[model samples]
Target chain A: MVRWEPGAEGRLQAAALNLYAERGFEQTTTADIAQSVGLTERTFFRYFADKREVLFAGQEHFEQVFLDGVAAAPAGASALDVVASALEAASAYFPDERRQHSRVRYAVISANPGLQERELLKMATLADAMARALQERGVDEAHAVLAAETGTTVFTVSYRRWMAEGEERSLAAVQADTLADLRALVLAAG
Target chain B: MVRWEPGAEGRLQAAALNLYAERGFEQTTTADIAQSVGLTERTFFRYFADKREVLFAGQEHFEQVFLDGVAAAPAGASALDVVASALEAASAYFPDERRQHSRVRYAVISANPGLQERELLKMATLADAMARALQERGVDEAHAVLAAETGTTVFTVSYRRWMAEGEERSLAAVQADTLADLRALVLAAG
Candidate 1:
């Protein structure tokens, strides 16, 4: 139910991403994207409020993945482990076939400061949601906040590595490696 | 020089804070803040870009403390230790005298969602600065990123505790406790 289905919304998003990447986000307009998909600007507006929404369309489902993972953790799991499970769950959202799309999306975002801020806001929202979920699971508030933030940091580092040139590992594997590195750093605190 | 010196800027900021708290951030205006300080609105603009600037006026020097601490870290310190040094450095920025000012400022920001986003952005920027400083110190990329983010999380949790009603711990003390808890969580990960 989450993938870009062969629907008007999907077609508009695909076209918008392609145009935004090729022509640059600033240089592309909603009409250009809609026209590329053989649709009118009105149709594009019907599906997306504007151009940026195309880049953020999956955010709700993506956040739900993290919340669901946090809720599913065992009662006795450590905060870090609970967060790791959430990070692992997010990997399913990014399959091997979607890597190119992700890479392009990352590029588009990197090229725009506004998009970058929006991306950071989205991550902050995810952290807040994960912390609340953990709290609901009977985790203490401070621990939940710390672990949820740590989860976002791991996801950020892993996401960058996944998008790095010539990187072949899956997002889950990269996230695991990053999580391990974080634990090692924490354990090695002098 | 940073401790709200007895000058027009300091008076304006203090007055703005008090008025924002009493009247609410949305209800207070620049003219009201200026008039409270017996200054003109034009004079107030000479000191702050806008009302929000009053809340963030100390951010630059605050960030400098982190960068300085990171730069001055002993060559062999662990990444977490380096981050701890930075966190300790920042504590001086929030002495007991400024605690009430901070509490009021926090309330004002908390009352407005936009201001909260700005605060998060400021924290994210601090993390980026600390990460770069760590990398410059030859710490590995992953470790630097993770430690810097962990440092911000410690700061956030500790600051909240510091601002909590009936809480009396120094910011640095709270930070140490939070850091220790995080390390414990990381060590206990399974």
Candidate 2:
């Protein structure tokens, strides 16, 4: 009988992360991850398509959060404002507790070209989704795309800071700060 | 005996594009491309690693144009200004002559997820390189990354416009228009 627990996915992810950190991502196997989680390999496949999916399982959920935030923004909000609100809401998903896990995952991802490619695609997908949401809010395609891309950059830079050692700021705070910096950069260019 | 001649790369690319357009990307084979170009399969391999590479052979040269532009910007130029100049310079590489080829290539790429992932990684790589160049010019890390990413977005939006049917404007013109739109979006959010 297959055992399905309330936190089976989390347990699998935690086990995968731990194994990846200890043995390196390339060295870790699916069976190792499953064994570490005290789950069958069949259960592992049920949650993730492969070992790589464990590291990126949150991408769809995160993209949905960003899209929802954009859709829920005030009707009168500017395109960039809607993106900022969306990024702010999305950042809340990465709490202080996730910093260490994120750091480990980042390291694993950075060392693998395949993982890096997936990461880029995930960000691109998020940007595309956000752009569509902005357009649905009556913004032009040009503005929508720019705002969505800018929002992704803000999230990336802020997330990097939030994951850095000795960095204690929340992801939302860092995102706001980076957004200000981007505004200054834009104004200076203009 | 191999018939090695000048413009072999260009010929191979043209043949690949024609074949891809006719038979679709997945259905076209490297042997067909080689035969169409009147070259041996070995000659095609010498020019491009694989079929997909024929469409992306100029990426390195394009990156060089952008980087050189960044490096040549005035000493007092802001990070964003450097990026703008880089983009302006890079836009010059995609002249009107390449528009049709670009459109066809875009269609082929859009139909394949693997190609889309590769395209996203290529853009990310460009952004990363631009950010590093900005950092080398004394820009702060946050500002550098934001400027680089925004520049990539500008290029993407402008390129799409330039590729659209019935669009006759120069790439530089489209890029300037998109940059203005981005500036307005940023200002509104600010």
Candidate 3:
């Protein structure tokens, strides 16, 4: 696979975002993104299948980070505890520096219903992956699914908060707080 | 808007299911469905937007039933209670008689990635609607989101179980059991 020259990926991503935001997503083409980034269209395609994928390219790594966390959770942790550890592990994928890129990506996605639906499907996929990872660790099917789904929910709420225009907290901090809130709400049902 | 005859809707749905099962969702056309039910293509168009919409048409009512429950929850109930109440209300929409229909629909959806993604987005939409309904009842935004998201997760888990092959429990009964399970799991964290 052709990799980006050092720091070139960021330049290409920035150019694509500017173009996608300036011109409508439908009207933009790979050539436009490539030209704007001073890279060949062949180079752009080498990195992403299409212009639309520019927004989704990081999803695999994001999920892998969460799955790694799940796989690395301490043995004997409760299902929810394992999920929490995984969530915290995934948070490192979104550092303080990456927030603006996410905010812009969220903006681009929010404006299009198809993109928003894709975003929802993407989160669901992450939950399924996490559940599978949990099950591999000997968690029962139901417990794995429940823990993963709820963990994904907490992460989504926190990620959205973290991506909010004025919110400044790290995804890890926001997610930690959200998980506690979910626990309190669930415990309240007892 | 044109309406189906007293039994026409059921007949159409049954015929569509048979065709979709035999020919697959992608190969099945709206005309094929209408013809199978001995209705004109015009009648088919009147009831559903497309072949795919036949599987999705009931979603609007499903979300509405849950929202009504949220709206009518006993005054001053806790946020989680309100969500649970809404979930129970929605259960009435899925009686034992509807089980086979759901089973077939779920099969059709699971076999198609596009349909599966749409299903995920639909569930996400339900959660958002539930959250908005909770907020209207004076629950704080954060509490409303956490409760609604978790409630939707529970409902999804229970619904999948209800639709599983050879599963005989009513959606309501299964949901109640699942809700209790979720409560136990959450409480275990304390």
Candidate 4:
């Protein structure tokens, strides 16, 4: 049993995503989101520090899972292998029910420069965390950083493909394909 | 004769860097920057769209040079080789006198999340552009993208090392080291 009930938080997220899609992220206010969700503005604030925070609440948890997975990877695994395993572990955390909402959120983020910047920052933070985790596993600093970056790039490309055409694909499958593509690309270049 | 006035842009960039470092990016207005150089705000705006633009104006010219260099790379040259040549060409365009201002600008940009995101987006855009350029030169799409990403990663790591404390190596030398590091990392992983 999950200790944390995904109730008001999830409701607020769904409400916020709908409103953001309907009225534009910039046009929507906290009060409006709270009112639509039949909650007080205070309730909304309790869940999200700010409007931007709503889009990023999952990042902390995701990063933790990713880092743990990397730390637990095989002793002799390469940095990329560690990161790839971590990405695979992280994939299970993304709920399938939220795919549509996730796509909408990405669309909104893509259109807004401020949101896009925040998204990039989040990704960079995740990469840095992963790099540090790899370093803890005896990987060299530069190799660890490169592996983290490559992993993030693979995730990015795979996520884009998964989101394209509004079609649903297993995160594991997409990630696997992305890694294969990366390996093939590198080999061909070599 | 060169069409553009030499060092005019450099002087403005230097002025902006000093003001940003002294008063912080948000606190230092464009007018403050222009006044420091004995120029008007209009002149500042003419050169830069906003305060942030001053830090990024050279990016376009740099990308153009890189793209041209990549295009002119020898047939059968490895993707890394092409990217390395492009980085070398781009390095020649970065004036030695700008190093101090460049460091100052990087410091300001690093401290601000907003600027950092825009910087990442710009780099992503450049990578995509470089991938497309490579594809146009007969490289497959997936391979081209991966090659471009690898090159960009090397460039980023090299630039960071160049900017790090007690690192007196030339940018070109740093870039070379980064490429070698990347190759070793990838090969070891494989």
Best by TM-score: 2
Candidate 1 lDDT score at position B129? 94
List, residue by residue over B31-150, the lDDT tens digit for candidate 1: 999898787888888789999888888788889988888877789999989999998988988887778878889989888866876787789889989999999889877778888987
lDDT of 3 by residue, B52-108 (tens): 777777788889999988888888888888988988898899899989878888899
Report the lDDT tens digits of candidate 2 across residue range A1-190. 6666779899999999888888888899899998886878888999999998899997878899898788778999988889988987888788889888889999888888788888888888898999898888898876787788878878887888888899999898888888888888888874
Q: Pull out the clashing pairs in model 4.
A: none
TM-score of chain A of each: 0.94, 0.93, 0.89, 0.91
Give the Å shift of residue A118 in candidate 3.
Answer: 1.5
Model 2 lDDT tens row, B103-184? 9989988888778878888888999999999999988887888889889988987898899999999999998998888888
- Return model 1's CA RMSD, one decimal: 4.3
Q: Can you list the residue pairs that collide in candidate 2?
A: none
Better of 1 and 3 by lDDT: 1
In model 4 chain B, the worst 10-residue window by lDDT is B1-10
**How many pairs in model 4 have backbone atoms within 3 A of each other, for residues 3 or more apart or on separate chains, i.e. clashes?**
0
Give candidate 1 misplaced runs (Cα > 4 Å). A1-6, A22-45, A49-51, B1-6, B23-45
Number of colliding residue pairs in each model: 0, 0, 0, 0
Q: Tell the DockQ for candidate 4.
A: 0.42
Give the best candidate by lDDT.
Answer: 2
Candidate 2 regions exceeding 4 Å error are A1-6, B1-5
- Comparing 3 with 4 on lDDT, the higher-scoring candidate is 3
Docking class of 2: medium
Q: What does the interface RMSD come to for each candidate?
A: 1.6, 1.4, 1.7, 2.6
